[model samples]
Target chain A: MTALTDDTLPVTSRGMRDEMIVFVVMALLLASVPFTGVYPFFVMQALCFALLACAFNLLIGYGGLLSFGHAMFLGTAGYCSAHALKVWALPPELGILVGIAAAFVLSIITGYISIRRQGIYFSMITLALSQLLYFIYLQAPFTHGEDGIQGIPQGRMFGVLDLTKPTVLYYVVLVGFLAGFLLIFRIINSPFGEVLKSIRENEQRAISLGYRTDQYKFLAFVLSGTLAGFAGSLKVFVAQNASLTDVHWSMSGEVVLMTLVGGLGTIFGPVVGAFVIIAMQQYLASFGQWVTVIQGSIFVICVLTFRRGVIGEIAHYFRRSL
Target chain B: MQALYAQLLVGLINGSFYALLSLGLAVIFGMLNIINFAHGALYMMGAFVAYFLLNLGGINYWWALLLAPIIVGIFGMILERTMLQWLTGLDHLYGLLLTFGIALIVQGVFQNYFGSSGLPYAIPDQLKGGMNLGFMFLPIYRGWVVVFSLVVCLATWFLIEKTRLGAYLRAATENPTLVRAFGINVPRMITLTYGLGVGLAALAGVLSAPINQVRPLMGADLIIVVFAVVVIGGMGSIMGSIITGFALGVIEGLTKYFYPEASNTVVFVLMVLVLLVKPTGLTGRAA
Candidate 1:
């Protein structure tokens, strides 16, 4: 006996047509952020995390794999891009691309080894692997141990664009966010993304359908890792620093909170979740350890009662994706 | 040779804690099928509880060894009944998330009250000195910890492997629904199993308090290492966890003597090797 699907909840779109319309509207809203007069730096930082969360959502929301070590990509790319800018004198765009490339390569190897197992085992592998990386970074000379790579020059966007100015940097981050968002949108709409969702919903059936599920998972992992890296690279510029904290397990936990708060398996959820969490942290910085406690409480409450996160609940209730 | 023997002693001490922690963890996992992320937090709490008893009520370390574990066990059982019990029928990952939240909350609360700086818990007067072996002078407290934890680990292994209650626990593990149909209060057993498992951690905490400074993060890092130890040992059996814990700890300790730089990573490196050889872990059944 099939129980009632939670799909009839409000904000849930009945079909793909409405999804496209809402997607356009959301993009337009983001496009208009320049006129809002809020601090460009904060928005830039949020967008970076949002993009990283969206990329993370691609795997968990669509592929049903919860990676606990995703911050590896974020931190790796941030460190890589920062190093490139500082040591190689590469401009922002090229440096960020290089960072993404490095993460993409690392994800391929990590994804390959990790995909050999599933579920809890998969999570453990990633966590342990990243922890291993964390130690390596802590010791590696370029990282400067605990102090991290700091005060890297905010190189100009190309030769003509001035990144030192806050407004210009804001647009750079905004564009990066939009590009990453659209890329996620494109992938989800594409055939590859559909197969991924099908696999997530029922892996056995997908395998029976002759789809190379492992390859798809590997590709998805790389894509997710690459985008996460790009976001991290962008964040280095926004925050003007890269540190061990970015790659720590806690950072990975924060991303999970973001994706969950926004809405897993829903577009636009990560953005909403990122802003809410980031704003919460910004205000609650003085509380120190309480932030962790509150975040944990939210995790428990959401998993137990909410089940559906903010955007997920809203989408489920209204019968449309916002 | 002398340095190697001393490093081995250090490794064994580390291993004793690992063995005890992993043994408890394996027991809980065997019954609950939920990885208790709060395990480290409970271990920390066990020590803190003892510390509190000593500082606040003037209860000494000896009394703490007796009382702290029971208190932690009862607390753990309550958690199992209240929160963890609900998540049972769902995905194993959900249980992990719930417990992780619990771990965060417990650690956060303790950190709030005590801050990050660790408090020292002194060794009892009974276990104050060291034995000067021909090769190595072993601290009495360290030797006591290794032997005491070994006794605890072996006793637990015997309970599960030889006794009747453990039989019920194991039978429930194989098929809880069937065990429940047989009129066994499987739910209560599961809850108690978690408590017992956590009690084991608390005992380790009490044992370890004197050796390692009691801190909010004491068990955080240690748990991760224990996880690697568990993976390496393969949680297929309680004996497996114990053997792997001690063996790996000694290996790590020896690594510290021979090639100190690789000491931090020797365990992880071994884990990678184990995965390559048998992805299920050295003693773990293939999932």
Candidate 2:
């Protein structure tokens, strides 16, 4: 699962230009969403998930660490951000920071324990740890148990940009998603990203080259988790609630599906995948549980036939790393 | 004292399920190199199969016990033959993803029909009463579940550790090419091994139905806990999973008595502690 062909493609200057072009095109398309009047709420929710999937892609797609419990970060961040905004009366910016900081600490602690192992064990360990948190949040008073921290206040950012306004919130979420996407994009192309990819491809070889592979993997895990937390914080503003649904293992699976559907290693794939899945859910909302069945079928199909994903296939056909 | 004994019994019963499920996981992992994420869903399917048999077919508990595993085992073999077989030689993660998809589909379809509620499965006539021991009153069906699960687990162990076929299975696990060179059909063995593991899970589901009630998502959360047990026990040996599963269940039961709040989290806590102390697990060799 970690060994996708796109990760191995040589990063020439032309490939970099192609990715930049796709990123700009994607940004413009998202920025013009409000004007197109295609339901700002749906796009905002999808943007949040797109960021989450991108954060997830940073780990599994590049770092070769598949943390099955990525939802823990998202849940923790949302809960914290919700509590901060609602209970503490913190501004939107501070609430988001609180969420990010909590996720940062959580990822560090979890990464320390989980990164000790690699491959499947890493996935299981992270999963177990996340379940541990899920139970904690279930019992914790701040989360209000099953009711969750609902009706969170979407306070103005710096007392200027009002988050309660839908259009303003959408742009804020869009900008947050873009910043996170670019950060991940930059990280993947950096020298450190190269080392992380090497560790993914062959950890022993990377270690032989004096890379201190564990630290590199640990850093990648932390970054991916924190960014996932950022997405969660952004999500609380959009959803106006923090609930168990975000933290559930099923949500983790959904992020994985999105990445797989969009193409794991492709820069633009998660963005497209996020839209595709969230749109599927929005359109198929009446089908209820069948959505899960459909998503599962997608997972099976992706693994069996569409392993390269939509973006992956397109990039492969064009011989470009979009 | 009575309450403690009761919780201990409850823990023992849970330990039985955990041991059965994790033991099957270890066996399948050894053969297939895939961590059978669908094991939980298959276990749930077993309970549902028993429900369907009793409610629809009017089959008795005893027959359901005999048939649920076989039926679910065949379903598992088909799954292995049709879907899981293609995952050979890919990254282990792909197998996990594929099986996870299977689980979601199975559980989702069941939930669609069952509505996420628990459906009752009555204890069989012979095991409807309770016996008062010196320490505690033991429900006969609960006792049956524990004892029967122990017997099944042990029989599985004996079959795998002591028999000729077991040697071939173990040898194939070590090197499928060499085992195939010795005239054993390796792929067939892989399918049968999957069936056996899945059958064990289904059997656990059957045992759990009367006590826990049949539910669509029954195995969903339980699988996560079993994964913790697997990590703590290290999935290295058969006995390791059994002992760890039971021990953790007992510990969880004790926690429910002493600190009810911690009962849900104790296994995961122990997994972390184990990883910190011995990353390879108690009886596991290095991964």
Candidate 3:
């Protein structure tokens, strides 16, 4: 999860301008994609994972925290939102909110305990907590054990826009992804984000500089978890089910893979990585177990050879943060 | 009371696997500074190797137990030479990611060939009976597993805590450069340590083959619990890992008897409690 060497470089106004231009262009391109005859559901699914990866990137890239159990947030949010829509019959927006709220609460609890330890221990703590939750969900009556919460209605957005239409759902997902992306962007540029970066670079130095580094890390973790939950909730609308796969550790690993492949620290890396991975999975679905093998090889390749990732490598070549 | 005894036996069996796996993790972490995420995959590989030996080569359980570990340990050594060696001096997280990838590859390959349905490994002829102590009947294999693993754990502890080779290992862990200056091949030691650790995981797999059906994903879920165990024990002390492993197993077994629904989650809940009370873990050095 190494950032590009250029990540340490000071951000200039010109660099910010260039980044803004790229972000807008990318957003516009994605917005125009529905007209291009590509499968809207596929893009929507990719967008959800992209948002999840971006949320994950906020912690590992900027805050130097590697959370191995991020699937818990996604799974928790998906299950909550699905339950809200199906059982409570809440509107789509409120259902999403319920999901995000569950993630928020979970993040606070997990983040509080996890921040006590650093490095590998933190990852293990998150993983174990998620696994604990996984077992709980596996037996919980609400989750239906092996069956999961299924056939969730894509309820109206704000009681107006019909989500049953593929195009409308796609646009809604896109908007959610963009808003989440912009929020992460703003957070990284904020003073709080700077403190997180400092802690990441050197925690002892940040502590000596009078920053309660743990608080910064904890806050970043919570934000990441919340956004990931938002993505998970969005995904439930498109996928129409909340299953055990969302909470599985492999799902967490997939998000990490996305972040790593796209560029751990780069702003746009995870989106690209998410699309790349999701598309690979989509097309290679018939390959069965080879997909896992391929994903594993990519992980080995990314770590051993190209630690900078796709966008990180590009940013390094251009000498600018992406 | 009989039910309690049965549950305790189950817990002891599970604890044997935890202790064996966590002990390997501690040994690897001590020398390599890597958590050895592939340890589980290697454990699964150990079981598969035993399966292959018996099915393909007409080998017996006893011989497979001895051979599988050696074979898997050699494979681990090769992995160290090829992939893991390059990751030295990098962040410990990289090692984790790399090993995670390796695990996926190993598990995926096994799944492709074997399918998810588990293959059976029969109990050896010598271990095919039970002893009845009036309260409950104890499967001899289960009892042997607990006793044998404890002996293995203690032997490993003694080797690391008392042997001169262990002294070199501890010295390397502290200051690799200083030890290198003193003419010890620390790199070779690191590689061998990884092999030894992988071998221990394999040994656990071989032991577990008859009880737990040999499946591709066998080690996948089991490793997570072992990670929880490692966290509670704090990867600092060998004895701490062993004691914690056995103790947590019994606790989980008791939980199974009283509250069967929570059997899967008891270890993790215990980890949370341990973390809340002792952030550095029970015996871990302050990081």
lDDT of each: 0.85, 0.92, 0.93
Model 1, position A305, has a per-residue lDDT of 72
- Cα lDDT of model 2 by residue, B87-186, tens digit: 8888888899999999999999999999998999999999999999988999999989889998998999999999999999999999999999999999
- Interface DockQ per candidate: 0.49, 0.71, 0.64
Displacement of residue B207 (Cα, Å) in model 1 is 1.6
Best by lDDT: 3
Tell me the lDDT of candidate 2: 0.92
Which candidate ranks first by DockQ, i.e. highest?
2
lDDT of 2 by residue, A52-153 (tens): 999999999888788899999999999999999999999999999999999999999999999987778888999999999999999998899889988888
Which candidate would rank higher by lDDT, 1 or 2? 2
Q: After superposition on all CA atoms, what RMSD does each candidate show versus the true structure?
A: 2.3, 1.4, 1.5
Q: Which lDDT tens digits does candidate 1 get at residues A197-249?
A: 88776777899999999999999999999999999999988888899999898
- Clash number by candidate, in order: 18, 0, 0
Better of 1 and 3 by TM-score: 3
